[model samples]
Target: MELSPSAHVDTFCRDRLPPFDLWPQLHFDLPELRYPERLNCAAALLDDAVARWGADRPCLLTPTDSWTYGDLLRRANQVARVLTEDFAVRPGNRVLLRGPNNPWLVAAWFGVMKAGCVAVTTMPLLRAVELAQLCEISLPAVAVCDHRYLEELQVADAPDMRIVAYGGGAPDDLAARCAAKEATFQNVDTAADDVALIGFTSGTTGRPKATLHFHRDVLANADTFSRHVLKPRPDDVFTGTPPLAFTFGLGGLVVFPLHAGAASLLLEQATPDQLADHVADHGVTVLFTAPTAYRAIMAAGKADRLAKLRRCASAGEALPAQVWEDFRTATGLRIIDGIGATEMLHVFISAADDDIRPGSTGRPVPGYRARVVDEAGEPVPDGEPGLLAVTGPTGCRYLDDPRQETYVKEGWNITGDTYVRDADGYFWYVARSDDMIVSSGYNIAGPEVEKALVVHPHVEDCAVVGVPDERRGMIVKAYVVLKPGLTGGVTTVKELQDHVKRTIAPYKYPRAIEFVADLPRTSNGKLQRAELRSRAVGAAG
Candidate 1:
């Protein structure tokens, strides 16, 4: 599918053209893009789906019930009316949504968009402190939460935010209120460039950064990944484990499926076992999940249930060659691994069926350009490891964050990932640029060590980080999670360290090892190396 010259400009305008025509020229330019523009994602995508696919087609499928395209539209409209008439939610208001992945959460997201309020979806695992911090940063006017997790949002320090509880049989009260409310609400006149959502990064290191996306960005993933990568059929059913708050989940579980007029199975609790069951029960054709979950499901011997899935996508971390091979051997389907960030909106690099290589993240998708660059921002030769830089339809646009200068350099969003492009143009994953460990002046990628450790029979999960040392400057430290029933002590640690020494470079072996029941992970399931690094520094001190 070759995009015409005007196609680029037309798609840009259509995707981003806000209701009020704010910052019209900014939409066309690159670096000069700014916020406070008019935008509403519900109008652009969900409403379009209702128009084309009609309301009778299944749009949201869960363990409890299924919602057709029309049902979702009506519920979202009812939600919009409830927010506007009852809760007093208005344009430019920031509304925080706290809940597990379910049909209500999806409805609330579109309703928030329909009401012209920015949606701030958070991970359900966050406690009061994390929730309070996000509320402080966003200063949200209202919060819609699942009654099951309401206690987590009841932090005393949170600024007087209004709360509306969903589920838990509030049906008699809230349902009556929803029925009395108007089912049709007009879209607020918003510019296509206005901030539609404030997606907070999983703060593995320091404070989480809120990456801003406009209405156009919500659909950009569909045009890029849905069109090029998965190519879902209208009859395909989609499901995943990533939280809807994370762009990874939102793209695969919500946007891609909705855009293609397919059904999505949204689970409040998506364990590997639950995922396998859903695929079998709902005939889910497309699966989106992390590499860790894939490994876990393979270990659990549930690969047979996933055979019905036609397309599978892996992200949130590197996909190990062994995991890829094991999944394919069991399910007879190649898992397409891609690398995406909140900044880029969705996966910028991925492989379709025929283009996949076991260990390599395929070349950049259409409408995007990716290259490896050196310290000075010069392109590195093919087969040389360097920082990955990307420029395309959807790039990093932070919300008045100082880190913008660091991430968006020279019109390209320089993802923190380090990679090497082979002569064949396949991009191989290295460690995060900040995660590169320097031991005795040798730069070793932590992912390489972690991948080696995962292949061990006794190791279930592991994270490799650098600890400060006086002599070596920084020494490799490994925090490992043993498989169930495996003992963790000096003997096992030594054996795992020896295993790493044999797998890759001898010097990359962990000088220090700690065994735990579980390793820290971000909301999206990425390893929290920054947290591990902090612990390592504290231990060294």
Candidate 2:
């Protein structure tokens, strides 16, 4: 239970950290991974970057405006002031950010860190109930949300949480408040081990768990994965489709570029065509997104538009070898594929340049170690499918959740993904070992969709499984047992899909629905998920 004397006054996150013995073994073997005892990532990424790269270097970009390192620094400093002076937000308080990716949202994230508060950034697509669950978990003192997306947060009504909107023309808006503040506020001198942010990930059971990351953990991902693998240049322009709430987008679009003194084009919304247009028009050198998007752009004949990209990264879900080969054949640039989890922060395993293996999730990045293990946690031989265990500078640290034991076992972060390690040390992707369905880079739980479906009056029973899709990698497909009187047809399928969307995030809704008399079940009454998944794959094949 030895932790640094924490800088957080609230102590909520610090108090909730899993005991040290339960934590996975953390490594800082790389020169870059070694950090000082007292470090604030906001200052290290923003202020220090501004100092090293000069103030006028462009840092954040959108279709509408560009923010220089100086511009972002001044605005971030102002945001820190507004939080303290205007909203009475104290150091160590959690500041929930709800918005699409934009310059203002970026500013708010840095500002919260600089103020020594934990930043809990949520996906803008989340509904009121979803937002309320996050609010209950983190207990943020203030929520700096996008003005256009204020209704859900308001409906959430988190107790004692003040809501402030950004990007509004109102006199009391966040923009106006920032305009009144000075741009030279001091950053809080927090310990390297101080809790910086809490990213939420849905477990196999569909329950969202909060993963706590320290200030040092924030930079460790960039230092190891981004530095050694992506090798971003100072002039690179970053753009991606994953929301900042997803650790993937945060690293690709914000943290990695900032660490390299490059510019990130923050798009509030991007379709495959729109992303291609932006990459071409904005002179984007580096692109981060899912394999589904890459295939969509190619299918839509927009692949040629991405000729400007020098480096492309694919994650969020497994990148199919065919997608990798096709994109390369289209653009003459190989896509770097990797696997990262919210609990671990960013990419720990990836390959770049000549080391690229078409479909394999390349060897672990510098400062990390990975292996395949059996159900008993013993290492499995190469070429055998088993649970992927990894140890790195950052590992799973769930906040006050018993599932910490489930994720971290025998001192290794056991990523629920099943993988086969070749004799060459390359990890080949197998199906997910857990009940989580990753579709188009989104991790959705089958049980969550099942939960939403059973509540509908029309559905007597339902089982959701991840079925293969060429574009999305995997799509949620639900097999249903409808009430005796109702005929499940196109109309009923539409009804169930709409019902699930209303109940949870729209992405988790089942894309395909088939009416069945009953679902396969064990004699003991357990759902036979593996059987359904196998049948779905066979049928798809």
- Backbone-clash count (model 2): 0
lDDT string for model 2 (173-263, tens) is 8999999999998898899999999998743234579999999999999999999999999989999888888888899989999999999
Q: In candidate 2, which residue ranges exceed 4 Å CA deviation?
A: 202-206, 435-541
> Which residue pairs show backbone clashes in model 1?
16-192, 18-191, 18-192, 19-190, 37-194, 38-190, 38-191, 55-70
**Tens-digit per-residue lDDT, 1-541, candidate 1:** 1111221111322233222212111122333222224446687668878888787999998887988988888888888888888888667677888888988888889998887778899988788988887887777788888888889798635767888888876763344556777777787656565567888887534566777676767866787777778899999899988899999999999998887889999887767877797788888899998898888888888888887899999999999999999888988999999999888878989997889999998998765678999877899999889999987767675554567777766666789999999998899999899989998999999999998998999988899999988999999999988989988888988899899999998999999999888888765678888888888898888
Candidate 1 global TM-score: 0.91
Worst 10 residues of 1 by lDDT: 1-10
Alpha carbon deviation, residue 211, candidate 1 (Å) = 1.5
RMSD of each: 5.5, 10.0
CA lDDT of each candidate? 0.81, 0.88
The per-prediction tally of clashing pairs is 8, 0
RMSD of 1: 5.5
